[model samples]
Target chain A: MDVLKFITCGSVDDGKSTLIGRLLWDSEAVSLDIREAIERQRKHNGQETVELALLTDGLRAEREQGITIDVAYKYFTTKKRKFIIADAPGHIQYTRNMITAASNADVAIVLIDARFGVVEQTVRHTLLASLLNLTQIVVAVNKMDLVGYEEAIFEQIKTKYLVLTNRLKLPKVTFIPMSAKNGDNVVTSSENIIWYKGETLLNYLETIPIIPPQTAESRFQVQYVIRPQGSDYRGYAGRIQSGVYRKGDKILVLPSDLPSEIVKIEENLQEVETAIAGQSVVLHLKDNIDISRGDSIVVQGATVEVGSQLQAYLCWFDEKQALTNGARLLLQNGSNTVKVIVQSIDYQLDISTLEKIEVEKATLNAIVKVRLRTAQPIVFDTYNTNRQTGSFVLVHPNNHHTVAAGMIVLNENE
Target chain B: MKINNKSFDYLDALEAEAIYILREVAGQFERPALLFSGGKDSILLVHLALKAFRPGKFPFPLVHIDTGHNFEEVLAFRDYLANTIGEKLIVRKVEDSIQKHRLQDPKGRFPSRNALQTYTLLDTIEEFEFDACIGGARRDEEKARAKERIFSVRDAFGQWNPKAQRPELWHILNGRLDKGENMRVFPISNWTELDVWNYIRRENIMIPSIYRAHLRECVRLESGQLLAVTPHIRLEPTDEIVQLPVRFRTVGDATCTAAVESSATTLEAIIEEVIQARVSERGMTRLDDKLSETAMEDRKKNGYF
Candidate 1:
């Protein structure tokens, strides 16, 4: 079965944990012993209802505080597909954890309370997901039973969300109305909303196609070299990330555009005829080239020029330090790491309003645009073209801490 | 097209990635080793490494940290696998660390050498100058492990910092380290228990018979744990000894390892039984984690791999 990875985001009281609990409980993912533990805890706490959120929140501190403190992964599967859910925290203090979880997700499930439609937290999550290049957004308006399952409220909330998501430039957006507490329109169709005509949230998740970024005619980023002992053949090792390559395809090594050929593709002893995106393998060439780590090996049809200047959308994750101009960092892309300096701050973005504010500086949990200069030239396409090669993280050299998360943008337009 | 006559999917992709990582360590790192303990997880790691570099001798040796108090069957199985594979095997005893005064014995009724394995492991690493030590640790096994990266960096003193870690992105893994520092690569970090069983079944790998049920003499301890009646175990008259049909769920130091009563004697039956088990693997097997809330975290910070 294919894998489907998605992230869950919302406010502290938005029932993100409860929604996950409902999904697991209704889908028969929880074992009987786990259920017994939940029951035992419920009795000890003097609560009448069995807390489903207890299933994912593993830490004792989280159980005592009654909130998610970190990104806890929950795995389950349907008949058609398998899933890995990254459940991120909703509190403002834990925004860094949310960013780390959403960075790897193929889809973002942005939950919103039906009673409070399009709140600041809701828009912030959507904006964060969009800024991270997660295009598939599923807006789940939870707590419909509290509002009497009113159709008018659902429609109003969906309309407001569509406008907000459109301004964020998300490629795909789907809206669903559900009550996680009562299990309405989550796993099964609810009889309350007769006017609603769409698949349940579970149905949509299983059917969504995980189409990897098309790297069909683009570039290849060489991560390392694979040399099997007692063999004269050597191959460039890395995943294709975007496009396809054949046995005799002519490729270019970036920063010099030196040409090479695909001699062979070997995993172990068996040789493969062709390789596509998402398959990690080694590529051998007829010539012994001066290829090393951090070098981009690209095909001829689609080539990207080397550049030292980059304009990117960055999410500041560090609360202890503020990002400003002339700040030095270790900019990492693929396997390459080089010193970088922040040249200028373009504009700080308002995630809720989608407005650009001209500011000299901003503190933690702020999203903004900036220009950077790297010590070494890096090659890539825009974030829209390839998600793997177009993203990077800025690490602090002194301690090797990941201070900021960045997404590649069009330098000309910005 | 099928790569190895198996259709390409996410799990298969993950398996290929893990194999690629194993091969990379063999090619790049100068001195490397595999840590084996005759456990199911570590057994699975050895199987993967064998497939990773086939038709040639294993590039690295295998090291086992002997606590001097383990089941005779498990220790025999450990030696059996190494000799059958025709690989060099090394054993570093905790008793040696005690004799050298590197570790002090905890004088108590329930004395365990589990935590002292760190000293023996580090000493062996220094003695052999091994740069990378591959382990079979899954993130879902424990909460602290979930925060671990694929290529986890350890300080010169072998300490792990939860707050300070190199950012890992895409399929790019940076295995570079300065002098005195080393990397602990976990190829099965993304796998779950169910996934491991599925793979084991699919590969038809041979494992120790202790994983299956058998009749054994055992005694019940104070913590409500059943300890096998081995010569290494100290028995008292107060301890109730009984004969039960039981098998080990996890193989570790014989003192801390517990056996669950069962009659599962076949692989297919064991797989079906695991599917219906309510308690997690670690919840019933591991006694070290029950000491505190952040026990694993504290151990990891102090250079316990």
Candidate 2:
């Protein structure tokens, strides 16, 4: 099965790390030393019982401050599938971290404290998850034991979360009521929740019939040109970011309009007949015209567009200052990067209501539509069609920091 | 033409991801080198590098920091593999750094030169001006490594500010750094010890013979730690030397890397043993890691790869 990557996020003190620790523990993924260390640290922290959160709070500063200061990636596996969990802090100021985690996640597990149901942080994380196009959302209503294991509280939170998910246009949402601290409804069936008739959190994760990715146009951006010593091989090696390519398929080199056919495809140094999304392979064309890093290959008859100006929706990441009009930055589109100017900030979306609010500057976590003009014409597609081609990140030209993540709405001249 | 839509096994997926990361490093960095240790992880990395850009020679070179206490078999295997692959292998000895008065060697009965290798590594990087140094550090091995980015950026002096990492999202690895700064890339950051073993078994990759069980002279310490009786080892009067069959979990500094009593010589037995083991690979072997709670974390901040 394909590996599932997801993020577990919630407001602080909502047991995000505890949930992760419990999952790893029940799955038997934690090593003996780490588990023993967790026990020792818990005792030192004055807790009579083992504090599961200590297992994930890796950095010393995080443990001392009792908060997750940065995003940490954790992995676990069950018999059915392999999983990569991105544990990001739930604080509102760490919106950039949440965005980073959500970008690659196939699903988002947004935890809601049973006592504090559907708060502001919950809405922000869900909206950001939606913005990142996470296919599935699982709202784990935690601390059910603290709430007396009542079904009514779970229903109330579920009702509120349903309203929020509807506003965000989230396609799939699953609500599971469980006590992460007590391991109820986490790995095994819970007897306390007699009214709940759904699978446990782990079971649900294992059996969710992973929504297949959309069939995008075949797009392979040339990452490196490999010319072997004392050999006749001139291969363009890169990952097939989207769609699929087969041997003998006609391809058009974008931005150059050069025609070619994939004479051969090599996977891990062996010739292969086909390559799909997410696999890196080297391709040899029948006749190499001109190619290097930053050039892309699309199906010959595919309608891949090229434009110098684009209308984009971007999440401002830089905390130093707000994103304003006429700002200069380098736009990194896959392996290609070019200088770009922020032409105008059209409007910022008020996340809570999903309404358009007029804003001249994009503050942190503000999702705004803006116009951008690049130095050169770049090949791209709508983000809805192909994420690799449609997305670009703005890097601060002066300091080389990524300032914002922009998704092309469409080419301006489309 | 039909495109193959087969899903990869866990190990295959990991290998593909590692290769993908190596390609990105090749495309981004002006000068890059693989930080090759004679350990199993580095052996796996060297094999992956061969597959990553094969049919063609690797664009980057392999670098090894000789701690001067490495196992003779491991060093010999490192050279043999480098020669077999026909790649440039650069060796920088920590003894050279000590001779140049750049670093101070510890003077103790049972001293490990593992920590001092960092100075030689930094000096080598500065001398070569390598913008990216790929290593075989896995996240599952340590807590601090779990929080690091795949493309971990370091300052000009090679300090790791755990808090100030670039937001690496999806496939866009922001490897943008200035002149003096460099990025430490870990292609197999997600692989576990068992995964590495499985890959080694499946790929039939060659590794040092010490990883297999062998009879060696060992001394039992008061703390229940077993020390191999190498020529460099300082023996205490009360310590008793015994011949036992053991295998090394990790092959690092000879003084610090302890061996576990096991007769599992084949790769399959090793994998089975790893699957049934309780302690982590490093926790069971690396004495340097047991000194403090954050020894790896602290060393990493000082440019230890």
Candidate 3:
């Protein structure tokens, strides 16, 4: 089955946990014993009905305080697809945890309480998802039942969210009126709302195309060099982030561009005739050309120049330190780590507004565009085209802390 | 050969990714060993290694930290698997540690040697000078495991500091470690329980028969778990003998392992049973996990694989 990884982001009491619990409960993905445990906990808490949020809240403090504290993963599979849900706490303080969870997610389900409409927290989450380049956003207007299932109320919230989406320029946005508490338009379609003509949330998720990092035109990076012992069988080891290579196919080794033929393909010890994008394999060449880690193997016409300077968007994750010009750190991209110095701080984008805010200091939760100078030539593509080869993380040399995550930008003028 | 078919593509992709990691470990680390137990996860690891070095022998040997209280079926199956696969098997016993006065023996009949397996493991790593030990720990298995990276770094003392892990970026796994330090690589870190079962069914892998349910002599514990009646676990005066249909989802030392009463005799039935199970397998069966909130993390710090 095709795998779909998604993350749920919202503040506490927005029914983020309840929506996830409802999806799991209605889909019959949760086991019988877990359901019983949640039921029992609900009765012990003296609730008239079982609280779905009790299923994902595993910690004692979380259960007692009724708030999510950390990122928890929940798994469930439907007949058509498999889903891994990264449930992150909605508080502002847990932004780091949310980023960690959403870093790998293909879609971001940003839940909003229908009564609250487009609040600041909603904007914060939407901004983060946009900043991370999460293409799909599901603005689940939950708590519709509390609004008496009124279509006008839903429309008002939807319109407000559309205004926010316009500002963020999200690639894909879907608004669904849902009552996560009562299970409306979540897993099961609500009969009360016949005016709405859209697939149920689960149906949409099943059909949504998960955009895996597919870039056919960008340069390919070779991560490691694998040599089978006692044999002349040597190969370039890495996953093909983009493009395709076949046996007897002619290619060029970058930084050198020494042309060679794809003699053999070794995925582990098993040999294949060809490899495509997303297949992590080792490619043996016809010649004994010097191809090492930090070198790129490219089809002759598909090579990009190794650039020493670049502009990129960065997210400052360090709370204790401020990122400014000339901040020295190790910038790692594909198996190559180079000493990078921040050359200039262009501008910082406000988390909620997405507006360029002129600031001398880019503090925590600030997203900024910066120019960087590396000690060595590095090969990369623009993050807009290829996320895998285009992104880099800055690690503090002294403490090995990941201070910032950078997205490579191709257009310097824009 | 046909790009038209995406059938088995995900598995093929995941398998290739895992093999690439295994070969990377072989090339990067000076001394590395594949940590093998009789468990299905580790067996999958062995299979991956075999595929990783086809036409040649595995680059490293297999190490099993024996608690000396393991189920005979598992031990026999372990040896059977090793011989059939043609790999070197190294067994380091906790009993030897006890004999050398390196470990204190618990004086009770139902003593747990689960936590003490760490010393034996750490000593074996030192003895073999294995700088990297590839384990079969899935992040979906437990909460502490959820925080683990694919390439988990361990300190010189075999301590795991979750807060001090290296930032792993897109496919750039850093295996660089200081002297006396080691790494624990989990290839199937993203795989869940259901995924493992599905893969086993798909691959038609061979597993010990104990995984399937059968009649077993057992005693009920305070946690509502059924413990298989064994020689090491002496029956108390009040404890009564009961024969129940049971099987183990996980295999560990018999002293600490618990069984669930089931009638699942096939992988299909087992998968259905797993789908229906309300409590997690680890949360239900493992007594050591229920010991404390940070039990798994604490054990990992003390070098328990």
Which structure among the candidates has the greatest lDDT? 2
Docking quality tier of model 1: acceptable
TM-score computed on alpha carbons, candidate 3: 0.89
Worst 10 residues of 1 chain A by lDDT: A212-221
lDDT of 2 by residue, A72-123 (tens): 8888778898888888998777888888888878778999999999998888
Against the true structure, candidate 1 reaches a TM-score of 0.89
Judged by DockQ cut-offs, the docking class of candidate 2 is medium
Q: By TM-score, who's the top model here?
A: 2
Tens digit per residue, CA lDDT, model 1, B1-305: 35345667766666767775776576557898888888788888888776566445667898898989878888889999999988888999999988886568754444568788878888888899988888888876776776677788888777887655554544546666677888898988878787777777877878788888999888877766777877566778798988998888788877777888788887777777777776667666676776865777778888888
Kept native contacts, fraction for each prediction: 0.20, 0.62, 0.25
For model 3, what is the error of residue B294's alpha carbon versus the real structure, in angstroms, after optimal superposition? 6.2
* Residue-level error in angstroms, candidate 1, position A310: 2.3
Candidate 1 residue B95 C-alpha distance from true site, Å: 2.8
Error of 2 at A228 (Å): 2.2
List lDDT for all candidates, in order.
0.78, 0.86, 0.78
| Model 2 root mean square deviation, Cα atoms | 1.9
Residue A288, candidate 1: alpha-carbon lDDT: 80
**Candidate 3: which pairs clash?**
A33-B278, A34-B278
Candidate 3 shows a clash count of: 2
